[model samples]
Target: MSDAQTQKVLDHIDADFDNSLQRLFALLRIKSISADPAFAGDCKAAADHLAGDIASLGFDARVRPTAGHPAVVAKSNGKGNGGGARPHVLFYGHYDVQPVDPLNLWHRPPFEPVVTDHADGRKIIVARGAEDDKGQLMTFIEACRAWKSATGSLPLDITFLIEGEEEVGSKNFAPFLAANKDELKADYALVCDTGMWDPNTPAITTSLRGLVYDEVRIKAARRDLHSGLFGGAARNPIRVLTYILGGLFDENGHITIPGFYDGVKDLPPDILAQWKKLNLTPETFLKPVGLSIPAGEKGRLLIEQVSSRPTCSINGIVGGYTGEGSKTVIPAEASAKISFRLVEGQDPAKIRKAFRDYVTARIPGDCKVEFGDHSMAPAIALPWDMKALSAAKKALTEEWGREAVLFGSGGSIPVVADFKKTLGLESLLVGFGLDDDNIHSPNEKYDLKSFHKGIRSWARILAELAALPR
Candidate 1:
């Protein structure tokens, strides 16, 4: 475990970098778009392709059938996955990608994968699933292949669970895991769907805030009425709807729902102080979004505003009619899509209940309300003392030659929580994705360096994990 030994592994990764790109290009060409049914055959093709590729590395690899698209379940056992002196690691990624719609925006055919350079002097690989999953997933697979080629086997036990429905919320993955619990068993999980702290610095995601998405509709009169005729008598549902959501926050900007904070707590003061030194300012956090104000709880630091505080936002609203000119009519109904970003231990059901109560209390006797379903997910916050994290952190820092930031993300990855609750496992979220990678958008790309060094990163991580004291 000396620095010299780790550097040797990294050198192996750099030398075999072209093979890594070739493996990535092969996956990117498979067209595994899961949300669209027309690509079902392509999805299966992608899964089978991955299974075949991983099998060459001496894994018991296969494309397992799911109710939706197929999943690649590949594993190499007993290098200590069952908690022998060696550690077992579950590496998660998606082989599927979002639909490449508005394909005209792309400079070239999305499925015609290629390694290209960005306008800035940085290297990039462009394709439909380039950086989203295929490229990202291949990072680990290529790393394993390199390790196997160099040292004859991955330094540690590793299981890969790349699915075809992650862009669609991984509907079949949880059940698949439960059915194959023993085969998929691992001490912890590693997810590569997240991004780095910056283009240059590496990051280990320690927390992902959960989500509680809801759609609320407000109804007043039974039918549309003339605003001029019923201006005083009929209730304006749009007005009522706006008033209800507008009151979701107080003057200090905290969510006003009762019990929303029931289980919410502060990050340890030491961690808070460390985050403060990281300088997560409005300039750094909001400048990209064209805003500078911290819009959460008034007294908290900007980092707390995003990572720790639960928030309620109205995503969309539709009510009155006005295609061109004013219709002068009062719409019978108004609906708004409101979502709550929940923090660790914040119950989605409780937050929904509190929000409904607040809305019902605000409604006039003449007005009625209905709620619609969107989606909800609980937050995940890992213990700082997890030994696996330390082992991986050492690898990342060594690979990048810079201190890797252990940080919290404001977004939610519900499956991470599902993995812990349903299977009793903690997941380590790491990846080489950068913010500008344009994930979930047309022309998505992963940095060529990210794809190249990412393989190397995992190679080092595997070696470090194998060296951990279990």
Candidate 2:
């Protein structure tokens, strides 16, 4: 296809932008919360809805069953394995969303998708899944729709692997991939579940932090005791737990876990220089959330502390509680949820063992500590010199009229590792989400400009990919 032909498809995307938004809104209305079992039927409904929607655009689509929630697989190939002449690309996204707890924080209903004005006057799409995998995924689908509508077919062989179990750690989706690896094979994968640098600046995630989640429980005395009778005489599990977990951090905000940073390394000097120029000050990042401190390692840039360094966090803790008033009792047990965000070269199993060792040594003779493993995965770093990366950078730069920033994301997408391990395929992560999108939080939104320009950006990228040498 010529450049002019791609331009025609871009023009179509611009002209039919409203219908594209309507399609996205339709998908967003489905309550596919995979974490909660009550929404199981809704998760299947979401898969069916997305399969039909993709089938409408001239692909063979199906809602395949998994051990848990269902997944949708759609393919657009003209014949004989998509003619075997053009490059094959697989696009991955998720239809499931985070559970909408604390619903009172939302300005409107979580499932009622609507375009509204931001406090600063920018138009935004407000809903639970907006700017997450749902809204970001549609950008690629809408681009494909434009290409098919304008010129009869996509520039390359396209396959879509949309799952309904991402937010729940994708425990079942990896097995689903193994069951269908032969069918999902492609030259490369495109993942649209990441974020841009800022609202105006586009970015492609080059590296991702790994994750190790643990649930620790400390048990002592075997029963609750009245504080009046057992005060300072009996063991308090909560105090012991808090004391140990609190010591996980020290005066300089460094994780006190031994050998936690053994494999972690600093970014190269060239990349460090580039990050310094970006200048992600606390005033711009932290101030929005009523904070003014970079709470990670001391003497590191805010960007490094967030995106490149290893750290640990206590996500939740619970021991004893009263319904409304005060309960003066010494609890027999206490537990806390801990997570470690690991950088490149760190080992998840090693980190998990180290954490357990650190906690076990501190347990008193009267107490026992039990751990429940939740998740563990190592980090991913894509080489910066891939030809597809160049194509995407050029295409994003053209759409945003500014250079696209390439940086490591502090978040983890474990499926990226699965894609590599299972299919032997590398993934290119691109999306238009912003830091303030509140994805997984209340009042989540997707900037209207991101939705519109994101479609156009993918349209150009598809053309560029098709033109690259195989």
- Across 153-261, the per-residue lDDT of candidate 2 in tens digits comes to 8898999999988898788988999988888888888999888888889999988999999999999997999999999999999999999999999999999989998
lDDT of 1 by residue, 379-415 (tens): 8988999887887788889888888888889898877
Candidate 1: where are CA atoms >4 Å away?
1-5, 78-85
Scored against the true structure, residue 58 in model 1 reaches a CA lDDT of: 91
Tell me the whole-model lDDT of each prediction, alpha carbons only. Answer: 0.83, 0.91
Clashing pairs in 1: none
Candidate 2 vs. truth: CA RMSD?
Answer: 2.9
**Ten consecutive residues with minimal summed lDDT in candidate 2?**
77-86
Worst 10 residues of 1 by lDDT: 77-86
Which runs in model 2 stand beyond 4 Å of their true positions? Answer: 31-42, 78-85, 98-112, 224-235, 320-331, 441-443
Q: TM-score of every model?
A: 0.96, 0.90
